[model samples]
Target: MFSYLVETGHTVEGAVKSLERKLADMKLQLLWKYDVTTKLFEQGIRLDQDYWILEVSHPDLTKKMLVQNQWSGFFLPCKMVVFSDRETGKTQVGILRPTSAFSHLEDPVLRDLASRLEEQLISVLNEIEQQQVV
Candidate 1:
């Protein structure tokens, strides 16, 4: 599936924080936070870059999906990523859209859920600005 990437003016850290704040306002619980390069740096592995992943889950939706298809677990808890372009101090935000996960699921209900998530994700992304770096 093609990525839903957005150019953001905020620094990588700022972008993630903004997204988290918006998600909280929407009542979405953040499930996990992964700092890719940071982890590697801790392990003495140099990445020479910055990357982060955030996962959010809605309890009710997750349970309903489990009852319908266990496979849906793979897509449960929406995820978004933030990565930096060191040279420009700009950040890029993206997600693997939930609607794309419905490709072979064959369930209208799930499709509806994904559609709603797609909207919410877009909504979240819309709240952040891609600032012009001078």
Candidate 2:
């Protein structure tokens, strides 16, 4: 699949905080956060649900990938989204699977690296899914 997603018992904010902690524990940096709902609102578009995009990266791994293939830098700093599911009244967190994202390159080594990264990212999402709602 192109993405790994999970429904969380927590609110969107709670899920985002949990993700921040999990990412830090795994030595991944949360580089940027885009509040999609707010942005849309500012543009006079009403998005009733909360949605956020988080950009995260492991410096060492990013450097290694870039060093090996400058083209890979295009995919640097993986993206994950935390959003509210209006239908279910639950929050969800998901990532664009690294392996799937890098598959376009068709490089075996990059694919292997992406697989490893995907595992770590999936672990983070799973941990968040397992957290108690707070």
Candidate 3:
């Protein structure tokens, strides 16, 4: 399982809908979507394959954390690892796969495929900007 934190580019309602369509097109099942503003987490219609969580959050909030501090994608909690900073003052997040499995996947094909799919999805969202009614 490869964990990726994709920047949705925009955090508006329209962006969320666009992302939903893009994910469907990519064949990645929409597991759930969390709305930070409303504190609501809705379960999406199940698809046939792998599950994905799409979260819509303000880029500005992340930007502030990144620019003001020396943080990268480490702050967010990933599906593979549950991390809490306050209690231990240490990061618990680690690679999604076991060390051996992760190390074994050294081929460029997987990377190329992911890049192509991401670019295609972003392009689709850039063209349509409206509230998604799923």
Q: Give the TM-score of candidate 3.
A: 0.33
lDDT of 1: 0.78
Who wins the TM-score comparison? 2
Which tens-of-lDDT digit does each residue in 1-134 have in candidate 3?
Answer: 44422222233454445566654665544455654333323344433322223432223333443454333234322122212233433322222322222224443443343344334434444443332335
CA shift at 58, candidate 2, in angstroms? 0.9
List, residue by residue over 62-112, the lDDT tens digit for candidate 2.
Answer: 887887788998898899999998898789999999999889888888898
Ranking by TM-score: 2, 1, 3
Question: Which is better, 2 or 3, measured by TM-score?
Answer: 2
Alpha carbon deviation, residue 115, candidate 1 (Å): 0.9
Which candidate order results from sorting by lDDT in descending order? Answer: 2, 1, 3
lDDT of 2: 0.92
Cα-based TM-score, every candidate: 0.86, 0.96, 0.33
Q: Give the TM-score (vs. native) of candidate 2.
A: 0.96
The ten-residue window of minimal lDDT in model 2 covers 60-69
Task: For model 1, give the 10-residue run with minimal summed lDDT.
Answer: 125-134
* Residue ranges of candidate 2 with Cα displaced over 4 Å: none
**TM-score (C-alpha) between model 1 and the true structure:** 0.86
